[model samples]
Target: MHIQIQPIDYSIILIYVAFVIGIGFALKRYIKTSADFFLSGRSIPAWVAGLAFLSANLGALELVGMAASGAKYGLATCHFYWVGAIPAMVFLAVFMMPFYYGSKARSVPEYLKMRFDERTRCLNSISFAVMTVFASGISMNALAKLLHQLLGWNYDLSLWICSGVVLIYVLKGGLTSAIYTEVLQFFMIVLGFAPVVWLGLKDMGGWVTLKEVLRNVAQDPAKVGLAHDTALASNAMTSAWQPIFSGSSANLMGVDWFAIIFGLGFVLSFGYWCTNFLVIQRAMSAKDMGAARRTPLIAAVPKMLFPILVILPGMIAIGLSYIGKDNYRLPPVAISESAYPAAVETFQKFAAGRMNATATTAALQTIIKPKLSEAKIAALLAADSQQKLDSSAIRNGLQDAVADNDYDGVILSLVKKYCPSGLLGLALTALLASFMSGMAGNVTAFNTVWTYDLYQAYLAKNKNDAHYMWMGRVVTVVGILLSIACAYVASNYSNAMDIVQLVFGFVNAPLFATFLLGMFWARTTSHGAFFGLLGGTLSSALFHGLTLPAGSTAGIKGGWLATLTVFPSEMAQNFWLAACSFSACLTLTLTITLLTKRDKSDNELTGLVYSLTPKVKEHDLHWLARPAVLGTLLLLACLILNIIFW
Candidate 1:
């Protein structure tokens, strides 16, 4: 499908980019030291930090990829927010924040070093830096793909434009610039997509109409050419909780509630929200400990509402397609040579019968003219007799032709179809903003890890603050360059979320166990923490490898060793893999700590470990203003949402 890009759209995008760059340059003078460059001088307010914390994770993947999943899996995708995100955000705010903020750790890895040892910190720092670069590339790649598909923009040009913009601003203002731009992007994204969802619902005749259409389509597999049975498809599309406990093969998400709760909710969620410095750095930049603690909690409010802006577009697109209002449809063409002969014969027979029986042949001719002509039908039949078609190939081609799975394009397609030119510019700009926010977040995190955790701490420990600050700027440029390379590599992957989850499984999944033990269990010796982390990471890789399908290169393909066993779905396999890895890490860490020498004194562990840390004295703050109160409210809200949606 060709999309016409209006001049207004280009102008709006250009203005947005310029404004963002201006913010970066405006904040340049603030980077007087490495801490200022990396941590925003720890002067950010709770609200600003909160939004940035949310925006950091709201990259191209969240917008495009989640929309794609919404179309594919229906309401079940809400698990990413309700179960996988909210609880973890609350945990980070209420439980983990004290240590993260009180310990004066510059990065998550730095925390590891203080809690565990230098080796563990090095392991985390290297892995996190690599992950951030790769993640930034993925966001960049997704943005380029969206622009190319939606606006007919050149892919390479899009990449260059976005990368250059992100690089300029992030280099100038560092984390402060990134956070300020993120806050701006957060507003732009909401303003941009809120109308899209409103307009979509309006076009689709509102919520009831959409659900009705989806239900009708789900009940008839032939309508959407779905492979699943009627009941499965209908329930999968309409209800969030009804099919969650069923076999993975029965639901579109390919996972049961057990996996959702344990794999995603417990392990992956905690690991990411708690330990991933890419996002935690935003909270760490807050003006005070209370602000830092409230950052994720503040962010969680909007985070919970994102599915409406991001996921609903895909759901609306799917609904429109079912109701025959969407432009996306299977082409009016046949795949099989043998089927073509029969089709032509049937048309010919119908034409001949109508001609003989009808008083006016003109009427019959008019009825069939747009679809097929007698001459064309005869030609098709003649060609069919002359050529042979492979039945299997024809079947596969037909399946591919009919499956409406370019879900990632759903939102872009909707914007072109429904949004007017001026509004289209705003929506497109919002998309660009989201991609920039995601990339900038990762790039900023990368620079900090590279400069402080890796370079300064290990390679140039004796360097002055001024030299390190300059190196921070230099490393920011290097980070963006590496991210651009990774973006090219990311284009090869089919699913942005899947590849990201795989990376989390590799790094975050195992690392969370170490953090969990070290923070809560005083017996967790540095040797034990280090070895357990190593063991956990290895076990994650081993489980992942063991589950690879016969020909797949990434993710758990299926069953153990791709043959000895089989899983219900790739998602289910991944969750189980994470659960196993977490258990292994916890077990190994405990066992190792029992055998190894412990830390010399509780004094050394003060403010870092739970048992040794002093309890924070209560402040004369309002009840509602407390982190614990806010966290409870957020958790309750999440639970209520789940129950309502369930």
Candidate 2:
């Protein structure tokens, strides 16, 4: 929908921007060395580092992509938080943080280098550098798309503005700036997005009534003109755990308990949380090993409740349509070829400017509106169930339902609908803050990996601190430029989370297996780690190439090699492919390590290997303050939440 921003909104956004830039200037004087620029000189306290750790992950993907997934997958989206993130964060804090912090490795790749071989390090560094840029680009794409969808801003213009702000702050204060700004973004995101959720739920009566509406919308998503998750139900979309056990055919997500537990819960979650440098960098910048270990654990608390902020809005947005509030249907999408030909014709007509925007949207929605008739929707709205919103007024803001539905815009659309002028600016700033946080986090990560892992390791040696610091700042600019290029590539996908999972599948899935072997199994040779990573990544591609999601074409979405099997959904395919990658990597690494001789002695492994590393003495801390105790409590809380939501 077209949104009209008032002067108050613009002023709020400007003030927020000024504040972040000022933070960079405030911290600039402290950036004295490459360590300061890249790793915050290891001085940030536990709380700041912990919030930054979570906020960095709560970027564009967390806001836009999670909301999109919520609309498409329903309560199953909570899996990303409760199942996927919490377990991994707990594991990272209790098990992995010691190696990352105690070893004093500059980055995740550097950790790999110390643990394995230069070949392994080189492969990881390059792949990681590329992955960071891609992630940053995805963040950029979400920001640009949001502005375009809501405010009619030019995509390129919004992208550069977001990148430029991120670049300025990061270039000036380095990782410290990014981390501190992320802390600020964390607050802004919560304060800003709170209104939309509160107002949306208030307008819909309460959670109880909203559930009634969600049950209706979930059973027939296309009844509200939704493009994704076209075949889900109340059981699959409304419950957190039921659909998982319902079997693939019974659930729209098309995955069983095994896929959810193994693929997502174990491999994908650990790979991203334990190993990905983007979030790990925040912990690595912590002032001490204690703070570093607590980083992810601290991040997990708010993360447990984030579904209310991010996911509920998407459900509410579609629910509004079902309850006849403002005629708030999801926008139509560019039809997949497997769908109706008439919808494609309508979309093309709108694309080619052969029809008026309003008329084209209505016609397109009608074609794709499914068999759920208008009478059923009218009767349901008039039925006077528990849904107690003002049902008399149904404004057809069909202008928003154009030929394309950027599901990433779900949260933004809600802000446009429910937020007042002052709150609108705040909400928009929150979106902007999240975008910058994601971009800056990845850019900072990219610079560190490039400067230390690749440039210093291979291209140059023994560089002075001044030279390395300069390179770090220079690489930040290069990363921004590369990220802009990658943003265009990201714009091709509808679901931001889908593309993110796909990237993680290729990069982190196999890398996790390699890291697992190297850290615990000291017998793992460099040759084994290197080839295992390569083979794992290649295996992920092969599995993806051989399998095609149902109702999907064979290309970038997979099955380019040949469609040997068809998955019920792209997400399910991602899960299985990641499982394949992890299994292949672990097997290959073990087999190769058996034949290869270890070049480094057990004594050399020291802090780098878990078996060799000394157990951390926690006698100094209070019982509640200990990382293990806190992490156990956190997991218990998470388990309670899962059961409550189930």
Candidate 3:
């Protein structure tokens, strides 16, 4: 794993780092006051906001985790970006942004406060803030682990490098530096992954060879096509292949088209686009409401295309395994059991011939080391069969010889192998940029919640700009340390994304359900929000506790329910995890809303039904129709690509 120090890689990474630092420093002048620092004085442009949005979403864990999943499953995993995320995003732009901007809230919880009551705002803000810390820590720990593994650096050192660098500029200039740096990071991520994809495809002997190889390896022709049975089956349980699907059992019925359309697909999308502080911060920084909405809409096109940027590389990695590419595939599953048969044969052959016994045993051990456990073999023999068996019995009896493997590592190894020097540098920089962008967003959101919800609302009722700004910096420092501690804890967890999102689901799922009800259901009370949040979270956690212990497997309880089952699969966990959360939240919200004392405010009642209002002056608002048409066409384009490439 020792890399030959390439001066070109060093230079490219150095230049990228310098560029980011330059942007951070350059943006410092905009921070004249606390509002300017935290919100960029509401003056950012659409394009900057757009790029920053993409960068904030992309991260090193995204690169590694996605590529790893692609390598493990196939093109099916790309659904998270393409089918799951994009349509939802477009929905966000067309329908949700207007409500958020038009409302003129500083944070999402602020919206809750305005929409519901102080208690709901405080509850959601604290939950979301804690969630951000947990999520950000996982991302940080993952990136740190990857860097540590890739560059032979210590994990703590890697974590410090990532957390410290982002914290410095963020604490210095807040959202202004975050936005500017993210634009550069977006380009870096694109530059880094794009060429590697090209090279992987080239190495696989082009698309035709890739097709041939896939046909050979998969033993199925339909796997390469959209709606292919094998692909669908592999991705069946989790809409990891498409956001519109899920599975359920007797204990839980899985997400249907409705759940996806309304819950994650619709609710999560609108929630993220309009309310997620990190995303809305960019919009909030915009000089006007039009730009706030337009920035996300502009960003939507690339958000749709991100599968091309991120997922395709992993798909290309899968394609690489065909056409005689050894770099991608690790040894097959059955190899662990079968390996000793071949090894023992070789050993017997050598012993009969001329190799020394000790030498032969050493060689046999080397060959069999990864496949057979000696204890398992001994136990198999010790079980006393009908007739006593000898060494030959042990060798021939071996049944399982699976090569234990790690696909995430495989993609990185491929990157190091085939990605040329300058491109390698670009890839590393892009990954770091993504990492920084994601971390910065998480940290920014954490500070936003802490400052707005706790500091201003509770701690200091009459603070001036200077006092609040100082508190912002102080809170940022404290938040960074807490995140670092979370990262340390996360170092021991497998699949950082899964763990982070699971924790998020357990907490945020209820919140998402409650918020949806609060905004749309006027009867939803503060009592409903509170109890709904608690009930939804507790129920999901209970289900998770029941099903998660057994290792993930296939063809069992399929999908995310499978994950929450004793048998886990990637989709299984996500599906049921979401199910538990959403159901608990919704059921509780409704039940409590019906029973609780309802608020009588006219504004509150009217707001719930606002979108249903007909445009009284349709002719006067005709200008809005053009963007709607354009946005539809854009959405259609993305759909066509999904049909073609999916």
Candidate 4:
């Protein structure tokens, strides 16, 4: 479970950390105004902005969460990138980036203010600022947990050290520092994880053997653990398309094509990629409109290929467990009888990840039934197959429970098992970079939005730019501190990825609809935009309140009202929540737009609204070099990859 950090390895990590701090200090001279601190002075080149755009997202969300999901959902986890990311990213590049960059608004919320009104801007800024901090906190939590679990470092101390390095760099260099650092992190991650996939696949006798090993794990009952479904276990694990083709019964993600397509692909994907300020801030910092439009497009090329670096490691970890080359095993997660009912969703998640829901449920049954008396088991089974097993004696009977694989630790554990001393340092550094990048991306975005969108907009207009720049630095510390507090909040969750998507559903899903209407539909009034946003957010909360996931209690995961419906899994719930939010927001925005008067004239909407603005024509050498052309090629490439995998 732990990697022994040699002195050389420690030296490598320390050197990287020192360089990170040095970059921040070096960039300190550039911070004259709030814009300089927050926006990188709009001077970054396209390629740098593009990589920074992509790297901003490569944090723990990619390195750990994707690996964890890959371990849990099998190949279907690729859907997050192939379905959920590529298309949205393309949309951002080709369609949305123009408005974002051309409007000259400091942040996404400022764009909303420019297009709509102050109330809308205020609402978005507040929510975005809050969400960024929480998102930042999740990254911090993942980093701290990684260090604590793998290196046996103190958890609290890890949080401080990780956050401290990021704080120093971001505090000095601001977005400029974070962006360049993210570029470095990007290469580190690739260099760090590329070998992981190579070493794993090579050890298992390459690609064919990797699949065979995974297939073996999927079909074996003893190895299947809580996974009970045997029929499509291999298919679900090995083939992404097969599970959906067989319907929800075989879908490893517990979501049908409709939910996968509309919920995750369209709603959640577009919501996060287009509107979330973290990634958008990178694009928004581009030197010109052409570079801005190209920022996400440039990032898309590598993004399409990142799964190999991230997801394969997790799959390799599981496959390695079945390989006789090493004594390493997937880390085990113990579920107490008291915690089992609450952890039903968690258990089914990874068990089903072995391939299909039936196996997960059956394996879950196998783990518990052995400890309970026949009568107690019967009673529990009679009441919804042990889901509502709340009796004291029944819980007492289930004292000796089984532990599941710690899916979240799959990638980090791989580093421990397979990597050599020096390579281990690079891998560790790469992981640390990803964690810091994700955290810094959020913190940078948070400070910007807090400074320009919230503080200057309403708090104090009389404050000079120097004062606002000072506030930006202050909020950097404030954001990281708050993120530390939120890390403890994140520590409660079983899946960091699921919680992130859930947060996006609440904050970003409805907001995308707002942007869509405001940009393209010039008729969308401030009243419509503001209330539509409110309606969408409320609907998401309302929907979540009414519906509970199958293996969960009635709490934050939903059913706070009454359990009107139950989703198959938490992932499914998150998808549907986003879908509902988007639909509600769009409908409400349209309905309210139809009823309300348009406050802004066509003149005022000129650069802000897409339809009202002139078509962007880049003064470039060739058509292929243009953002749209590049974007089209990227989409085609993405489609080809999807089909090849399918």
The Cα local distance difference test for each model comes to 0.79, 0.82, 0.64, 0.80
Better of 1 and 4 by lDDT: 4
Location of the lowest summed lDDT over 10 successive residues in candidate 2: 391-400
Q: How would you encode candidate 3's per-residue C-alpha lDDT over 1-646 as one tens digit per residue?
A: 4445489988987787777777777777777887877778888887888788777777666767777665544554555655456665565555555555556677788777877778878877887888888778877887776676667668888788778788888877788898888887887788777777778777777766664554443444132221122322333322242423333221111234444445555545544554567776776677765666667667777777666566555556555544335644432223343566677576446544555445554565676654443444444434323345455554544432223344555446667767767777777777788888898888887887788787899878787888888888898888888989988887665555455666566776556677567656666788888788888878877666656523444332223344434532334455555666777788988998899888746565443324432322325345743446556777788678667654
Q: Give the TM-score of candidate 2.
A: 0.89
For residues 158-221, could you state the per-residue lDDT of candidate 2 as single tens digits?
A: 8988788988999999999999999999999999999889999899899888888788776776
**Tens-digit lDDT string for candidate 1 (151-242):** 77998999988889998998889899999999999999999888888998898999888888877766664555444444555666767777
* Candidate 2 vs 3: which has more TM-score: 2
Those runs of model 1 whose alpha carbons end farther than 4 Å from true positions after fitting are: 225-233, 326-404, 492-504, 548-562
Writing each residue's lDDT as its tens digit, candidate 4 over 1-646 gives: 3578898888889989988888888988987877889999999999999999988888886678888877766778888889889999999999998889988988998998899899999988887887778777777877787678668899998888888899899988999999999998888889987887788778878878888877776666245342434445676677767677677657557778888889999988898899988999999999999889889989988999988988887777777766645776666553443555644544434433443444434555655533222333333344434354444433433332333566777887878877899889989899899889889999999989998888887888888788998999999999999999888878876566455646556877787889889989898999999999999989998998899988789876889999999987777888888899999999999999999887999999999988889989777548788877888898899889888878
Model 2 residue pairs with clashes: none
Which consecutive 10 residues in model 3 have the weakest lDDT in total?
A: 246-255
Off by more than 4 A, model 3: 220-275, 322-402, 492-501, 546-570, 604-627
Candidate order by lDDT, decreasing, is 2, 4, 1, 3
RMSD to the native, candidate 3? 8.1
The RMSD of every model to the true structure, in order and in angstroms, is 7.7, 6.4, 8.1, 7.9
